[model samples]
Every structure is written in C-alpha cells, then in structure tokens.
Target: MFLSKLALAVMVWTLAACSETSGWNNVIDSHEPKQGESTPSKDNSDTTLASEPVSVGGAFLVCAADDSFEMEAFGCRLEDVTGEKLNSTDIKDGDLVVSNGTQAYSAVAIEGSESFWHWYIAAPLADVSLYTVQYVGQIADILNVETEVQIQHPEKQVSEVTMESPYDDRHLMFVTSIAYQAGQVQNGFNSLASADALCNQHALANGLPTSFKVILSTSTVAAAERIRILYPVYNLEGNLISNPNQFWTNRHLAAVVADKMPSSSEEEEDVTLFEVWTGTSNSGLVKGTETCADWTDNTANEKGNFGMASDARKWVDDGGSRTCESRLRLYCLSQ
Candidate 1:
C-alpha cells in the first residue's frame, strides 16, 4: 500500500543506475558537461533520503495480486517502470515499481490476504513535505484506487496536507523570451497580420512557442479587445509580468500604465519611459486624426499617438504622438 523512506531511496538509486544503461540514458548523457568543463551540482538531490523525486516526465507502474488479470489493466508501463521491457510475469507481490529502470518498492503490499489484491500508482508527489509516496491513480482507469496511499517519511511528520497542482506531462506551460523587431514596419503592415507574423517568427527563432500575437491597436479595434483578457502573463521564471486585473479595462489609461509598469518603480521620483506605438488613448480608443493614414502609409507627415511604458498615467495615452517613420517595440502576448 505504501513504501518506507529507506525503500524509496534504494529504488531511486537502482533506477537511476539502470537508466544510465538504457536508451533513455543517451538523452541524459548528452546533457552531461563536455571534457574540461565542470558538471553542475544536483541541487534537487535528496540530502537525507536515498531516493530522489521522480523526474518530470518519467513513467512508473501499478501492480496487483490477480495473476490471470492483465497487469496492464493495473496501469503500469513496463518499459517506463523497468528498463528491461519485461511483462507482468517479471513482477512479484509487494512491489511498487517505476518504469524508469529502478528496483521495486519492496515495502508496499496489499493489507489483507494474498487473494485480496490492492495496488497504487507511484506518481510523483507535488508536495514532498506531506508525503513521500503520494500516488494519483487516475492516469489509467484500472489503477483508480478508492483512496490515495500517502507514505510519510519517518524523519519528518506531516502536520497538514497542502494540496498543489499535480505534475502532468501534458500540462506544461512556457513563457517566451522578450523579443524586439529588427526594424520598423509600415503601420498597415498587413493590417496587424504582418506584426503577428513577426512575433511568431521571433518566438520560433528563440525556440519558444509560436502562439503569440502583437499587443497593438488599430483605429477600429483596441489592443485590449484583440488579446486575451485577465491573462496571467509570466516571465521565464514564472513571475508575474503584467498586472492581471487591469489588463482588460477599456479606455483606462492609468490602469493600463499601472499594469504595464514595473511594481518596484511605481513610486520612484523619475520613472523610466517605455514609449511604444499605440495609436490609441487611455480609453483604448483611437486617439489622433492621423494614424499613419489609417495605418496604410508609412510616409505620412502626420503623427500617430503612442503611449509611455513606464508612466502609469501616460502608459495608455500620454497625449503624445510619434511620426510614422519612428521605430519602436511592440508588446507581444501568448495566445
């Protein structure tokens, strides 16, 4: 039903060593430092326990007592749990196994007689403090246990269970690196279609996700209406990149400026100015009579409105305009 800390540690070590020789080993070995270069420290390695946490995309197995019943029905990927690619015949009673070429968890077993079989999936625990082996059995319907089996470490007693989002391979999210245009394009560059293409191209070159759009405004459509509302924008490290609540407010210049500006410099005496092409007002409405001749002409002598990136009151519409020939960065968002 559950594993002891010592047993989990042994399993991890055996599995890690086994992984070094399996096909997956090529993936891990390729990341190793080259000759004359120093290897980075394993910051996440367990200091007290022998077994480390399951890798982000690693696989494991679930087993039970019924001999005739398909072990696959119990929901363990044989290859992922054991590097040998063996079938259920290789598994024995009282074993909690991982597909990552590790030793079976010898301590885990069904509570009752041999005929009364019980099994649990060996999933990675999101919160290590609450449980050493907390299994989520929903990956396969056959492995759905009535209650989760939580094995606590002997050294650390869990006072309360703090539930966190469970790690899932399919649910990963990534933020793109900040990018800029190499040069300015015409205001009517494909009527924002070209601008969006530029954003996607930069993202692709940087090995980032290509699902991005330019944060710009046209005479008929506001920037706020074009992108996602209340989106939780983040930097690479998962830090909030923009104000969540104020991003969607219409024609609210102060709110727009506050949302885009850095929080640390909000009260500074001299704030940084982040001017960008907006052609819009604080209310997200078109501001000037001239918008690069409705964004079609880059040579228009008339000026188009722009906003300050750092000025809270001026971020949406500082009542300023820049010539159509001027070049500036466009804010991009993941769609």
Candidate 2:
C-alpha cells in the first residue's frame, strides 16, 4: 500500500523506536508483545524496559520475536560492546553464530546509511526456544552467549497480526551510495572483503541492513557463489528484485539505491545507469581474467569488468570492461 511521505516517515520512525535499539541502527526484534513481556515506550517513560540494549564484550542481544508472515522466528541484533555502531569493518556473518538450540541460522547483515548499523540473524522460533549468539571471534575474542527460554506465539497470517516492520525480516538488496575506482578498492588490495566493508558502511550509515557482500567476481570465485542465501531479494523500496533461485536469471522490478529515505527525487534515483564494477558476466561467472588483476591493479595497463547500473539484458554485466583506474560504484547484496 502506498503511504504518504509524512505517514511513511512516522511509521518508519515508530518501527525504529519499537523494534530496534535506541541510538543504534541494529534491529533485534519485530515480534509483537506477549503477555508478561514488556514493550519500550516511544517517550522513554516505561521504567520496566532496559534503558539500553544489554550487551557483553563483543555484542549484546535484545530478546524479541519474528515478524515474518510465513514462519515463527526469533532474531537479535549484534552490537559492539563499546556502545559504538558495528559496521562491516567491525563484524561479518562469520563473526558470530545464532542458534535455536539445534541448527544454526546464518547471520544476516542489516545495514543502511539511513537506519541501523549492526549484525543481525534470525532462527526458527520454537514453542519455547533457547537462543544463543556466540561471538566466533573472527574479529574479536570468542564468547559464548545465550538467552533464556523465550516463549513465542503460534504463527499466524499477516491479516491477523500487526507488526513493526512486517518485511524487515526478509532478505534485501541495495546499491552503494559511494563509488570507487577498480584499483582504489580496499586501498589497491581489490579484495571483495573490502568491497563488502564499503557496502556495510553505506547500509549502516543509511539505516539499512548491514550484511552486504559485493557482487563482483574474481577469476576463482563466481559472483553467483558469493550470495549465501537464495531467498527472495527486495530493494529498499520493498519491491521485488529477484525471486528465490532466480537472482541471476531474472530482471528486477526496480533499481536499488543507497538512499531509502522518502524523497521527491526517489523516483529519479537510479544507480544502475551509472558504471558499476562487476567482473562477472550476465551469467554471474567471471567474464574474463580482466578483473583489474583481481581488482588490485589500478594502473592504466590493467582493466576490469564493469556493467551499467541499468543493464536489462545482461543483468549486471554489459559485456564491457574498463581500465582499473576508472572510478565506479559496486553492487552490494544482503545475504
């Protein structure tokens, strides 16, 4: 449904206040309140709720339920212990593990330049589930953290429930707000990890989900293999970009952008028409060995593959390659 800009802003604000940690961009919960469970007040008048998110050394967990329409799940936001925002540079999907006492759920990065900035993951919510978020110490010391048994309500249809951000739990995608040169990526290292950091930076800064990976491919790894999860992907506008198992094969509903804020110019905001660094062909495989020397070579002699931000036939690759010295943007997808 279309909402007015003011109403949309208000709804988004309320969702942020209720479903996320205050002053932080990480989204920990989207479930409605249960009996005996407390909800934070918008005015900060509720004395029962904790003033800030309870965190340990590496991160903290906010106990909450899932808002996905299809399943009952639980999720928590991972925040830095220092009370600072966690970015891609700070945390990655590999840095932590979230479990429902049985199987492990892959951590999803929910980063945006306009909203939250932290690592978040969700697991299937059991009737009475005990969840744990353990710091894998890929970036810090290992810490085993667990939560008390959380009682979740039975799953129901969207029509029977009210939610904070109904679609917030779904997989998402976005474009980078800033652009980089081929050789300038990661200070000439041209590592995909560095590009991932840039994506997280933009997502965290823009209040979007932070778990983003660059869509570029190298000689060894295909861009299609970089995406961990294959769920339906949506743009910041909540429009369908790709259905499950068809990301590489389908065209998107609209172009993803860095700025998600309601704007008069939002309709005009398209990043795809510009040059984006993607060494992968339309088939999601490496187009050639011309990956700017694995995105490290920035000299004029070296070249890298690129695509128009608005490619229709080739998806991302436009069958074009440019010198590594050329400045371009990167396509980041949230897994």
lDDT of 1 by residue, 128-152 (tens): 1121222443233221122112122
How far off is model 2, as Cα RMSD? 26.1
| Candidate 2 residue lDDT tens string, 48-69 | 5433332334543323355642
Report lDDT (CA) for all predictions: 0.41, 0.57
| lDDT score for candidate 1 against the true structure | 0.41
lDDT of 2: 0.57
User: In model 2, which runs have C-alpha deviations exceeding 4 angstroms?
Assistant: 1-169, 185-189, 260-272
Error of 1 at 270 (Å): 19
TM-score, predicted candidate 1 vs. hidden true structure: 0.36
Worst 10 residues of 2 by lDDT: 148-157
All candidates: TM-score: 0.36, 0.45
Q: lDDT score, residue 12, model 1?
A: 96
Off by over 4 Å in 1: 1-190, 235-238, 241-243, 249-273
